[model samples]
Target: MEELDEDNMNEIKDKHEIGTPEDHLSEIMEEAEKYHPGYGASVMTGDVLIHALEIKTTSFCTLRCKDCTHLIPYTKAPAHMPAEDLMDDIKKIIRVAKVAGLIFMGGEVMIYPQLAELMEAYSKEGFYDRVGFVRVTTNGTVVPSDEFCAAFRKIKNGYVVISDYGILSSNRDEAAKKLESFGIKVNVIPEDLQWRSLGDWHHRDYSKEEAEELYRKCHGKLYLHLYRDHLYHCYRAPVMNEDGLIPHSDGDYLDIGSMSVEDLSRRLPEFLTGLSCTKSCFYCDGFHEQSPFVERAAQL
Candidate 1:
């Protein structure tokens, strides 16, 4: 093992910060338009009836799915959001942005003991009905207790969205049935796609051909919501990965209330014009998909 000196350590840290800089907001926005038309602009304008606000409840997962893209591999222990802080942020978003819904996502939200408390807080605030809907995206491994389910049942608009990997242990069907028994709407994402490993990240790779096939099978479309001061139409995964977890335009976590629809719309052209550098753009699926720059660069 070679010893790493102080200078060597600093260089490694710097490299990680610039882990993938060529990946820029402009390129992502352009790719958004190409892969999913009108999605970018719709999110910016809030024309879509539903808007998602995700609170990562627990940062750790009991099961290790190969293509886990939440960057869970980088840390040993997952972080949990304090219920108080989580509720405060939720209230603020609802009051300021007129958001339609809230999504609780995580390594596993059910595993967080305080999840029931957090949900109850929303109901107590009288924002429950106005909340439009509450959805939880989980890996479908841990089954919530009867008491937990009872609490979730109290929220009239609550539901669960379970992602089914092909692994049998996920027991997605059983989980959905159980949640439905409690009068909660259960949406199961079937395991139609195979998981592929990309370096340390595991993802469901839908090649252009595979994606088209999957679209037909699911009878739906893939959409992305890019959130800065507000949401922008996007596939969510790639743009957030490119922005390095902080909102690029304002150097803050995305705060929906602070943004205007017009401001988000105007940024689109700027994003398109800035996609010349190709370093960070390499990992994106949009690279292969058709786009204005892709056509122009091909000519050059």
Candidate 2:
């Protein structure tokens, strides 16, 4: 694997300037020779392929829980990603990949100002038709405004995934009620939940074999993140990188905004799935099969 210098990393970040999901879906569909029943396209990244894409809108949340998979609570400063930036990545992904589901999430998804507009864009592109479901994961604490709720109703197939924190959420019921009233399905994650220490939130070293084994057992590895211009195999990388908890390398992610489907298909899986583990793994708790039950949404 080649080492990525700081200059190259910066350049990669600034490279994207074109395309949208709607614009390229037709081209991708042509190249997508195989298709799953509910999943949209059939494209390959090396030998590995995915039917789902996880879209993380922001790292800023309303509550500061101790254990966040996203490592958002540990961020020194969290902010909502610009809606325009997020839409750009979504466009690039839909162009190159066929997806069965799209998970829209954030620090607190309700707080994003463009929540309604984002949903609208996805729907306008007929994104809902391509996937089994389009879900927005939320803490169930913020009751969305009229506009946001309206967007949910309009999408028809959109779902509200609520992580109910029991006593921690003063508005959980209200929020669910509002969403349900709009005829949106509410998927609830009860307060009683399993908790695992993702990591010590510090760096550690591991051999390639060990890291690969860890990745196999890790759940975060399943939900590859599409944020900014990069596609990350694990959701942990961006937040951990932002907090200076892990070193950033080109090997750690794919610059989806810059690379063509041919280029990504040939090279992505080598560094993405071939790696033993990510730099974030050193700081992460690795995996605990029997994650203990803990208080949901307990504050620091």
| Candidate that scores best on lDDT | 2
Backbone collisions counted per model: 9, 8
Off by over 4 Å in 1: 1-50, 193-300
lDDT of candidates 1 onward, in order: 0.48, 0.66
Best by TM-score: 2
TM-score, candidate number 1? 0.54
Give lDDT: candidate 1, residue 147: 70
| Clashes by residue pair, model 1 | 23-280, 26-271, 39-233, 40-233, 66-202, 67-202, 67-203, 224-234, 224-235
Q: Per-candidate RMSD vs. true structure?
A: 14.3, 12.1
- Candidate 1 lDDT over residue span 87-191, tens digit each: 665555455443344667666777887888877776678764334456777767777667767777777666788877556436676777888898987877665
lDDT of candidate model 1 versus the reference: 0.48
- How high is each candidate's TM-score? 0.54, 0.78
